[model samples]
Target: MTESRTLYGYFRSSAAYRVRIALNHKGLDYTQAPVSLVKGEQQAPDYLALNPQGLVPALSDNGVLLTQSLAICEYLDEAYPDTPRLLPAEPVARARVRAIAQAIACEIHPLNNLRVLNYLKQELGVDEEARNGWYRHWVELGFAALERTLANSAGPYCFGETVTLADVCLVPQLFNARRFSVDLTPYPRLVAVGEVLERLPAFAAAHPSRQPDAPPA
Candidate 1:
C-alpha cells in the first residue's frame, strides 16, 4: 500500500468511481475525501485550488496532485508496476483497451456528465424530460458503436478474460446510465460485459452505494 494517497471525489461521480475501482483493483490503500458534487462542494475554493476545472476526482499521491480519471489510472498502473496492470504490455492490445475506455470516457461521458446536464437545466432552462432525452441519446449512440467494437471479444470482460482499463471505465458508466433510465437493451454485449465486471470484488467495492459519502439505505 502506498502512503498518503487521497482521492477527492463525489460518491456518485462516474469519473471518481473509475479511480476508486482502479485503486481497489490494484490493491492500493487510499483515503477518500468526499467532495459532494450534489452539494456544490466541488466548487469550493479549496477544491478549486486542487483542480481548477472544479471536477469531482482529483487524486493526491503523497502531495503530488493529479486530475483526470484516465490519467490517474494510468499513473497508478505505471507507478506500481508490481501490481496488477490496468493496461496490456502489447502495443496493439493496449491501444484497443484504451480505445474502448475512451469511447466511454471521451465520447459518451463528456456529453452526459453532471456539469453538462446542469448547464442544460440551469443555463439554457431545459426541461427534465428533454434533459433525460439528451442523456439517453449520447449513451445509446456511443453504446451502439461500443457494442460493435466488443462483438468480437472472446471474454467475460470488455477486452478479454483479463480485466483492463476498459472494464474499469464501463461499469461506472453503466451505473450512471441506469440512474438516468437509459435503455440498455440495445447494447446487450456492453450490458453483459458490465454485469460480469460488476460482480468482481474490486468493482463491487467501488460502487457508488458502497462509498462512505453514499446515503444510508
Candidate 2:
C-alpha cells in the first residue's frame, strides 16, 4: 500500500549497487524490478518512461519516481531519518562523508560505466585492451586518493565506527575494482575498511553476486 516501494536496477550496476547497500543499511523492505543492462532491457519503452536517461537504480517510492543513485540515497535518508542516518549530524563531518561518496560516484564511476564503455568501443573505436586501460586508469586514480582518505579516518567503517554514506560507496567501488583485477596491495587501508564492511550483514546482503538477477555461474 502506502509503504510499498520498488527499485529498478541491474544486478551489476554499481549505481544500483549503491542504492541496494543504502536500503539494506536502513533495513527497508522493497520489491526489486530487474532491468537487464546487458540485454538492453533498460531501453524498453516502459523503463524509458520511468527514466528518460535509461539509467538503472531508479526508485518508485510512494508513487514518486526518483532517479540517480546518490540522489535516491539522499531521499531515503531524508524520508526515513529515524533509521540509522547515512550522514553525520555535524555539518563538517557530513560534508566529509559526502565528499568521499562523490569521490567515487562523481569522479570514478561515470568514467567506467557500461554506457561510457560502449561509447568507447562503438563510437571511439576503442579495442578491448584500450577499454580495460580506461577502466583501470580511472579506478587507480580514484583509489589512490580514497586510500589516503580512509587512512585518515578512524575505523572499521569509512567515517567512524558506524557505517555511513562513504562506506556504502566504497564497498561497491572496491567490488568493481576487484572484478577488473585492480591490485589491492597498494591500497591497504581501503581494502581493510572494505573487508570490515563486507563482514556486516547489511553489506553482505547487498552484494551484486547475491542479487536475484545476478548472472549464473
Candidate 3:
C-alpha cells in the first residue's frame, strides 16, 4: 500500500490546485490541511517550520515533507506506480509534457502569485488596476506561446489522448487567468483543452470550488 499523505495548501492557490489534480488523478486518498494564504496562515511559525518558503501545497508523505507542486506530483507518480501515470512512458514524450507544464508553472505562475502581486501593491505602491495589468500581461505573453505549443501537440489533452503533467498544470493556470480577467479568446486550443479536462471526475473534484477551504460564492 502507498503510505498516507497530508497536503498543506490554500483553496485558491494554482500550485495547490495542481497537486490536488495530480493526487485525484492517481486516485490517491489524502487529507488536506488548509494553510490559508489570504489569512496569512502560511507565515505562521508552525507552518514555516514545515516549509520555510511559506508556499502553499507542501506535501507530507509518510512524514517526509515535500515542497513544490510539480515535484510532489512526480513523487506521487513514482511512489505509487500502480496508479494511472502522469508522465508518458517514452523519454521524449515525457520531456514534452514537462516542458508544457513548466511553461505555465515556472514561466507564468511565479510572476502572478499572490505574494508578487501583493509586493507590487504594498511594497511598490502599485494600484489595483496596475496590479491587474501586470497579471494579465504575463498571462497573455505566456499563453500566446503555450497556445502555439498546444496546437502543435494536443489531441484533446495537452499530449494527446492521455492526460499528462501538462494538462494538470494547464487547468489551474487557466482558472487563475480568468480570475484576473485575462482575455482567453486568442488561445482557442488551450480553452478547448481546458473545457474537456474540466469535466473529468478527477479534475472536477480538484477544482478550487470543491476544495474544503473554498469560500462560499
Candidate 4:
C-alpha cells in the first residue's frame, strides 16, 4: 500500500497548483496543509524547517520530505509507476515537454511570483501599475514562445492528445496571467488548449478557485 501524502502549499500558488494537478492526474489521495503566503506564514520557523527555502509546495510522503514542484511531481511519477505518466516514453518528446514546462516555470514564473512582486513594491518602490506591467511583460513573452511551440499540436492537450507536464504547468501560468489581467488575445493556441484542459477532472479539481482556502465567491 502506498503511504499517506501531505502537501503544504498556498492555494493560489502556481507552483503548488502544478503539484496538485500532477497528484490528481495520478489519482493520488493527499492531505493539504495550507500555507498562507499572503500572511508570510511560509516563513515561520516551523514551516521553514519543513522547507528551508520557505516555498510553498513542500510535500511529505510517508515522512519522506520533498520540495520543489517539478521534483515532487517527478518523484510521484517514479514512485507510483502504475499511475498515469506525466512525461512521455519517447526521449525527444519528453525533452520537448520539459522545455515547454520550464519556459514558464523557470523563465516566466520566477519574475512574477509573489515574492518578486512584493520585492518590486516594497523594496524597489514600484507602483501598482508598474508592478502589474512587469507581470504582463513576462507572461506575454513566455506565452508567445509557448504558442509558437504548440502550433503543431494534434489537439485536446499540450503534447498531442495526452496531458503531459507541459499542460500541468501551462494551466496555472495561464490562470495567473488572467488574474493579472494580462491580454491573452495574442496566444489563441494557448487559450484554446487551456479551455479544453481546464474541463478535465484533474485540471478542474486543481484550480485555485476550487481549492479549500480560496475566498468565497
Candidate 5:
C-alpha cells in the first residue's frame, strides 16, 4: 500500500499547481492542506518548520517532508515506479524535457513570483501598469526561445506523444502568463499542446479553480 500523502499548497500558486498535476498524473491519492500565499500564511512559524524556504507546495509523504515542485515530482515518480512515468526512458530525451521544464521554472518564474512582484510594487514603488509590463516582458522573452525549442519536437505534448515533465511545467507557466495578460498567440505550438493536455483527466482534475482553497467564482 502507498503511504499517506499530504500536500500543503496554495490554490493559485504555479509551483503548487505543478505538484498537483504530477500527483494526478500518477493517479496518486493525496490530501491537501491549503497554505494561503496571498494571506501570508506560508510564512507562519509552523509552516516554516516544514519548509525553511517559505514556499507553497511542501509535501509530506509518510511524515517525510519534501520541498521544491520539480524535485518533488521526480520523487513521486521514483517512489511510485509502477505508475505512469514522467521522465522519458532515453537519457537525451529526458535531458531535453528537463531543459524545457527548467526554462520556465528557473528563468521565467523567479522574476515573476508573487513575492518578487510584491517587492517590486511595495518596496520599489512600481505602479500597476509597470509591474504588469515587467511580467509580460519576461514571459514573452522566455516563450520565444521555448516556442522555437518545442516547435522542433512538439506534437500533442511538449515531448511529442508522451506527457513528460516538460508538459507538467508548461501548463502552469501558461496559466500565469494568461493571468498577467501575456500574448500567447505568438506561440501556437505551446497553445495546442496545452489544449491537448488540459483536456486529459489528470490535468483537468488539477486546475487551480478545482482546489479546495480556491476562491469562490
Candidate 6:
C-alpha cells in the first residue's frame, strides 16, 4: 500500500504546480499544506525545518522529506510506476522529455523566481519596467526554442500524444508567461498545446486558481 503523503506548497508556485500535475497524473491522493510565499510564510521556522531553502512544493511521504520540484516529481514517478508514467518508455524519447522539462524548470524559471526578482528590485535598484523586461527576455527566449521543438512533434500534448514531463513543465511556464502578460501569439504550437492540456482533468484540477490556498476571489 502507498504511504500517506502530503505536499507543502503555495497556490501560485509554478514548481508546486508541477508536482500537483504529477500527483494527479499518477492518480495519487495527497493533501496540501498551503505555504504562503507572498506573505513570507515559507521563511517561518516551522516551514524552514521542512525545506531549508524555504521554497514551496516540498513533499513528505512516509516521513521522508523531499524538496526540489523536478526531483520530487521524479521520486513520485519512481515510487509509483504502475500509474500513468511521467517519463516516456523509450530511452531517446525519455531523454527528449526530460530535456524539454529541464529547459523550463532549470533555465527559464530560476532567472524569474521570486527571490531573483526581489534581488533585481531590492538589491540592484531596478525599475519595474526593467524588471519586467528581464522577465520577458528569458521567457521569450525559452519559448522560442520550445516552439521549434514542439513544431516537429504530433501534439495535442508536448510529446507524441500522451502527456509527459514536458507538458507538465510547459503548462506552468505558459501560465507564468500569461501571468506576466507575455505575448504568446508568436509561439502558436506551445500555445495550442497548452490550450488542449489545460482542458484535461489532471491539468484543470491542478490549476493554481483551483487550489485550496488560492486567494479569495
What candidate 2 gets wrong by more than 4 Å, as runs, is none
Model 5 ranges with Cα > 4 A deviation: none
- Cα deviation of 70 in candidate 3 (Å)? 0.5
Candidate 2 RMSD computed on C-alpha atoms after optimal superposition onto the true structure:
1.0
Candidate 6: regions farther than 4 A off = none
Model 6 RMSD in Å is: 1.0
The weakest ten consecutive residues by lDDT in model 6 span 149-158
All candidates in order of lDDT, best leading = 1, 3, 4, 6, 5, 2
CA-lDDT, candidates in order: 0.94, 0.92, 0.94, 0.93, 0.92, 0.93
lDDT of 2: 0.92
How many backbone overlaps does candidate 2 show?
Answer: 0
Mind giving the per-residue lDDT tens digits that candidate 1 earns over 119-173?
9999999999999999999999998999999998888899988999999999999
TM-score of each: 0.98, 0.97, 0.97, 0.98, 0.98, 0.97
Candidate 3: 10-residue stretch with minimal lDDT: 146-155
Writing each residue's lDDT as its tens digit, candidate 5 over 146-192 gives 99998799468999788989999999999999998998999998898
TM-score of 2: 0.97
Record all residue pairs in model 6 with backbone atoms less than 3 Å apart, i.e. clashing.
none
14-106: candidate 2 lDDT, tens digit per residue = 899899999989999888999999999988999999999988989998789999999999999999998888989899999999999999999
17 Cα displacement, candidate 3 (Å): 0.4
**Model 2 Cα displacement at 1 (Å)?**
5.7
Model 3 lDDT on a 0 to 1 scale: 0.94
Candidate 4: worst-modelled 10 consecutive residues by lDDT? 152-161
